[model samples]
Target: MKSFFHVIPVSHVIPANAGILMLVFLGLFCSSFGFATEPQAPRLLEVGVSDVFVPQGFDDNDNAQVVVEGIFPTTCYKLGPVKVDINEDTIKITPQAYFYHGPCLQVMVPYKQEINLGILKAGTYKLNILPDCPENRHTLSIAHSTNSGPDDYLYAPIESARVVSKERPTVRLHGVFSNSCMSLDRVVTHSESNRVVAILPIAKYENNGACLDVLTPFHKDVQIKDPLKGRTLLHVRSLNGTAVNVIEDF
Candidate 1:
């Protein structure tokens, strides 16, 4: 007769605490491999700011604004709100992007956004975009409030714009004036760097008798004739001390 006792292997003998730990380890491992039942959620990520465009100058009453450009590595990204932190003379702008929770196309998308920083007191300020990089930055200068003659006025707010014809290219700007006293005085077009024709629409304020408190709609067409085989940038001056940009292939 042989011994009836059976011996269990050491590997088969798992303590109660070890079993719980193994369960936790398996849970972590599954999560690491995205094997959990939970679905991925959308998120926002900081965009890589490439350049910032600041105005040549600003008056104390001027609404300061800057154009920001950045790139998105994937097509699943959409333009997000800009986070701005102003501390004394230093302004920090963090461009953001919304990431869609799904398989995104591997493509680079360039984006340009205009940030309106309402009137700033007369002073020189440093604008830092993507402070993490420490290189994407620009300076803005705001002149003290000087006597503004009747002839001087800010460009009207450009609500919407478009290039009517690429052949005899003309940019059309449609916007509204604050009141009936304001009117489109003239449109001055000048070609700047990169063959960008800047269309500046100056508004004229009439102080003769009284201006009716009414919103006035105005449409102006600016003729910008140029030959750029690849593309042409239309940097049009608008309200808020900013410029609206329109790209067209000419």
Candidate 2:
């Protein structure tokens, strides 16, 4: 009796080692093709600015108190850290973070935080609200009060000053004044040649007895004799020779 030998095809007979290699290759290919899962985007939380307080006497190196309120979602936990950064005239706030839960199982919670931003100047400041989660940021303009007391005279020139007529060149002066007594005596113009070219007396509040102690708003149209020229400055002074405010390039 003759024993016949069986011949199996190489393609049909896959070795155990080759089977493991093919599985490893398939996994690598799928991962490279982005079959793996991706990370989720951060949740957004609502934040608002309740109030901002800048003390009257705060100088360039004084802290101002800011009150902020917000609501946290139920899908996360509040991480106990708040970061604040103060630039020249800007305040940035970074709120606490939230750890992800399985799902949003609870109701939204309300939270309030008070931050003391140190050493700010007495002027307009920009406050920026930044959160760790993915949400739109916010900005606010706040005016820090000056050190000038209520009794102390304070004046701020209005942004818009107009020359109604160039022929007579009647200048319109507008400003706000606060405190115990202030009078706009005259509008004096100085020329490039360093000479007093024109002196226009403010008719309404000129005399010493004409001064008033209450907060006053002044808008005066004064007539000038000579035409102003060459980088002139108009000085609006009190009767006591103290300059209340000056308008340049008139």
Candidate 3:
């Protein structure tokens, strides 16, 4: 006679280990569901063009003049990195508007509470005091470029650069261009002062499509060349619009 035998599995018999098995399952479930914590990134504050302190920069390609308008918090507050937002219409200034124009405008806010933005472009912006700070101040300026015309076009690109070591020592420039119609008539540099220094052209009328020269950096007023006749190859505006340096034709 065949006798039926009963055999219990070891896993079933070891019921005490069920707790460990449940814990393992629980850990896996937690991991798969992303129960782990993570850190968040900091958000940057946004600023806008509140107003313009000055708006005298010349237009090159479009002969368009830009109006400086600074924008800030309606209430007093700190400041942060300036985010520049521009459109095609607001980007280029028209020649006619140069003579008769309103102030350019923008809005801005502090990314951090400790940041304090001093003077921005003045005539271009309008600000109201906030309860946070009763005394908020700023100024603004413009780096003028020459009026664009057929006779004076094709600005020379900056090919080389050098830093001055002397207190009042002079700096030199050298570069080549694809077109020969342009000349190196002058240069403008931005400095601590708020004036445009006119550096004399060392190499003028370089009809060979390239030129080079040197000029003294002793003047508080710094500007590369004639703004009305030529265009600026390099137009670098400072945090405050009032301070700017231009590399262009006079």
Candidate 4:
């Protein structure tokens, strides 16, 4: 190594202009490490969904919805507005989060968001979740309706739900109705299989008298006596054209 440095001719040495080259190198180095030296503002970034749950089926006039589940790296990350775009046969779903540049706790924050896909013609469609998501492409089938009109009962829109107990778990649901006339009719619990259960809280609307545009809250407690093992999904329907999916592992 000493012989290589010694081989350089004295006349080929860099002149005083080498100061400019050194400054440029230093600028590039600082730019690479600017975050350590300066404060950065919060950024709006997209997070990939871990899982997406779609309802059993949909009709042409029925409202379509899917529940999206994701996780944040830290507690500092807050969930932001979701941007969705549907073009013909494909629906693009982008779940966003707000990342604050400060002291962030090292924890995984799980999140669940519901997206209403609205009505679609009788055909097959694709649900495309944004970049680096698990199973980005999901097939959605919409069947043609032969019924005369829509169903009399609509599912109450649930805000949050949880399993109160593991053994003989009691599912607690809290939601709101659009008007005062709409009330909780009954809680229908259907066990598709051992692990999959669908709870439909049908809302009965009695528009016989004068009804006001009021938001009324409702609560329901569903007891599950059937034996369930492994992963269980409680797909609860919502009146606002959405579904709240609660996944429980026993």
Candidate number achieving the greatest lDDT relative to the actual structure: 4
Worst lDDT window (10 residues) for model 1?
145-154
What is residue 1's positional error in candidate 1, in angstroms? Answer: 43
What lDDT would each prediction earn against the true structure? 0.74, 0.49, 0.33, 0.78
| Tens digits of lDDT, candidate 3, 117-143 | 332222232222222212224222332
Q: After superposition on all CA atoms, how large is the RMSD of candidate 4?
A: 9.7
lDDT of 1 by residue, 109-139 (tens): 9888888787777888888878454743467
Output the better candidate (1/3) by lDDT.
1
TM-score of 1: 0.62
In model 4, where is the ten-residue run with the lowest total lDDT? 1-10
Model 4 residue 79 lDDT score: 84
- Model 2 scores a C-alpha lDDT of 0.49
Model 1 lDDT, residue 13, Cα: 88
Model 2 stretches with alpha carbons more than 4 Å out: 1-12, 15-17, 20-22, 25-62, 77-106, 122-250
Q: Residue 160 error for model 4, in Å?
A: 4.5
The clash count of every prediction, one per candidate, is: 0, 1, 55, 2
The model with the greater lDDT, 1 or 2, is: 1
Order by lDDT, highest first: 4, 1, 2, 3
TM-score of each: 0.62, 0.31, 0.34, 0.64
